[model samples]
Each structure stands twice: as C-alpha cells, then as structure tokens.
Target: MTDVTLIFADLAGAAPLVMVLLGAAVFAMSRVSHDPRRMVRVLIAIGILLFVRLSFPLVIPLLLNDVIGAREVQVRVLWNALFYSVPNSIALGLLFWTIFDVGRARSAEEMTRA
Candidate 1:
C-alpha cells in the first residue's frame, strides 16, 4: 500500500471512535438539566457534531482511493444516512420539547394567577 493508502486507512479506522464520542456527548447532554448553561452546551455540542457528521462522508472518499474499503465502507454509508436524517429528527424533537415546555410554563402561570 502507498503512503496515502496507509493514511486513508488510519482515518477510516478512527471514524468509529469519532462517532462513538459524538454519541456519548449527545447522551451526556440529554442528562443535563434545563439550565441555560446546560442548554447552551448541549446546543453547541449538537451543532458541532452535526457539522462533523455531515462532512465526514465527503471527506472519507477524499481520504481513500477505493471509497469501498472492506471494514469501513458500511460505516461510511451509515454515517451518510445519519448525516441526512439527524437534522430533521432533531428539529422535530426540539419542537416537541418546546411545545411541552411552553405548555407547562403556561400552566404554571395560570396557577399563579389563580
């Protein structure tokens, strides 16, 4: 294998590690309280992960010549799907959360008014 191929394999090998870290970050963010600090952190983390995830497929092919490596091709495909799917799913989730939060806030206001 050429030097370039070695580098490509190295990066492809690391993709799973990056994805696992992203997943862990999301899981940790989900546990955070509704405080503004926590929310900001979560949003920032999500944004960064989303950007990276979206770009990974594009970068992967550039890093490798075959674009169909034995071990990592499936990962590339899955990430490509996830890159397209996550934004809409996350938007829906946030929308639901917002609706629930607003409803609760309004209910609390009504209780205070009573």
Candidate 2:
C-alpha cells in the first residue's frame, strides 16, 4: 500500500475510542427509566454519531482510489455532504442538548435546595 493508504488506514485507529463511546451510550441508556423519550433520542443520536465515525475509515479506501472523485474539491464536497456537515451537526446538536438539559436540571435542583 502507498503511504496515502497507510495514512488513511490510520483513521481506523480510533475504532477503540468509538467502542468506548458506544459503551458509554449503553451505560447512560441503562439509567433512563424515568424518561423514555430522552432515552430514545440519546440512543438514536449517539448511535448515528458513533456509526458515522466508525465508518470514516471505510470511506478512506474509496477516497484514495478516486471512486468518489479525483479532485480534492469533489472530495471535500462529498465529505461535507455525506458525513461532516449534516449528520454530525445533528449529532453534536443532540449531544449539546443533552448536556444543556442536564445542566438545567441541576440548576433547578440547586434552586429548590436553596
């Protein structure tokens, strides 16, 4: 394989990290008996995010081979359209929403305690 292929193959190096993310999602999901809706959203959004990240290395082979396109611009457009721009946006939004939700809940609890 070329150096380019080797470099792209390194993208899969994060596969273990993705597994950790999935495990965390499953653990968080186990604690959500009180809110089925939130649980579903969290699972779906995190699943999508994890799968997208996990599959990034799978696309590198196509990218190196010019199956998608030869030009860098075409590759950028494809990456943005297919993976980086839309799906990640929604996934990250959902992640932030979860964080915000937890912060708000904590704030409310502290207010009540005070």
Candidate 3:
C-alpha cells in the first residue's frame, strides 16, 4: 500500500477515537445505580477496544513491509487475524449481552425501590 493509503487510514481512525472519548466523558458525568454504571463502563470499554482493534491492521503493513518472506507474512497475517477476531468477537458479544441485560438490572432496582 502507498503512504497515501496509510494517511487515509490514519485520518479515518480519528473520528472513532473522538467518539470514544466523548463516551468516556459522558460515562463520567452519569449518575446511576451500580449495575447501570457497570453497563456504561462496559460500553466505554467496547468503544475503546473497537477503536484500537480496527486501527491495529494499519500497523502490519507499515511494520512488516519487506521485513520478511511472503510465506511468513501470510502466517503472521493469519495469526494476527485469529488474534484479532476471536477476542474482539468475544468481548463485543459479552458487552452487547451486558447492554441487553441492563433492563433486568433496572427492573431489580425498581423492585427494591418499591
């Protein structure tokens, strides 16, 4: 890939990072029960993880270009893809589950308050 492509990728990553920062700020300002706060924290974590995970692929081309054999590059990319995908899927899934289950927590809180 050209340097121009790398520049574009870098530019693309900025917005998500900004959004994640904004989410962090919102999380800080939130006043909620412990369980709801936990859900917000998980959401913030997922956002940061997403920004890092998506931005990571850009590093490979810059780091490995002409540094190794094609076969080695393939192996590394495969390993990176596996390393990249599985953990992200697991984390994202769990975070989404937490977000979905927030209603249960809210309902329990309501029950206690009543």
Candidate 4:
C-alpha cells in the first residue's frame, strides 16, 4: 500500500481512541467539579490537544511530502478531514463549557449582590 494510505489507515484506527478520550474528558468535566482547579487543568489540557490535533492533518502532509513520498496525497487528505472534524468538535465542546461557566459565575455574583 502507498505511504499516504498507510498514514490514513493509522489515523483512522487511532481516531476512535482519541474520540473516547475526548468523550471521557467531557463527561468528567460536566459531572465532577468538587475541585475546580483539577477540572480546569483537565480542560486546558484537552483544549491544547484539540488545537494541536487540528493542525496535524493539514500540516503533516505539506511538511513531510518528501519523507512520505508515495503516501503524501492520500494521507494528506485523510489528515485534513480527521484533523478538521475531531478537533473542531472538541473545541466547540470546550467553548460551550466556557460559556456555561461564565453564565454560572455571573448568576452567582448577582445572587451575592441581592
């Protein structure tokens, strides 16, 4: 098989694992907040991962074309799709969390004023 195909296959196989981790992180953040610091750290880590993963599929093929040779085209396309979809999904989740947190804090502040 071509190198690109191999790269695509590897990412496809690994995507589900990443999804599981992301899902677990989301669930943990939503359900457990006894320790806000711990949850924040987890969210930050996941955010960074999401950012990095988003770039990989798009950047890898362009940067590694020489090394990837025959596999470049297919792998690049696959990476583009995977990176765009997965990381964006996670990023959206994180954004939603931030919005919710902000709303909660604002409500609490208003309650305190009352």
Top-TM-score candidate index = 2
Query: What is the TM-score of candidate 1?
Result: 0.30
Query: 22, model 2: CA deviation in Å?
Result: 1.9
Where does candidate 3 stray beyond 4 Å?
1-21, 28-37, 40-44, 47-58, 62-77, 100-114
Cα deviation of 67, candidate 3, in Å: 8.1
Worst 10 residues of 1 by lDDT: 62-71
> What local distance difference test score does each model get?
0.58, 0.69, 0.62, 0.63
| Model 2: lDDT of residue 3 | 64
Decide which is better by lDDT, 2 or 4. Answer: 2
What is the lDDT, from 0 to 100, of the residue 17 in candidate 4? 58
Worst 10 residues of 4 by lDDT: 63-72
TM-score of model 4 vs. true structure: 0.42
Model 1 segments beyond 4 Å from truth? 1-54, 60-79, 107-114
Task: Report how far residue 103 has shifted in candidate 3, in Å.
Answer: 11
Cα shift from native, residue 86, model 3 (Å): 3.0
Candidate 2, 2-91: lDDT as tens digits? 365664566567778788888979876896775566677788778877877766556655665566554576766676476556777897
Reference-based TM-score of each model: 0.30, 0.61, 0.49, 0.42
Clash pairs, candidate 3, are: none
Q: Report the candidate with higher lDDT, 1 versus 4.
A: 4
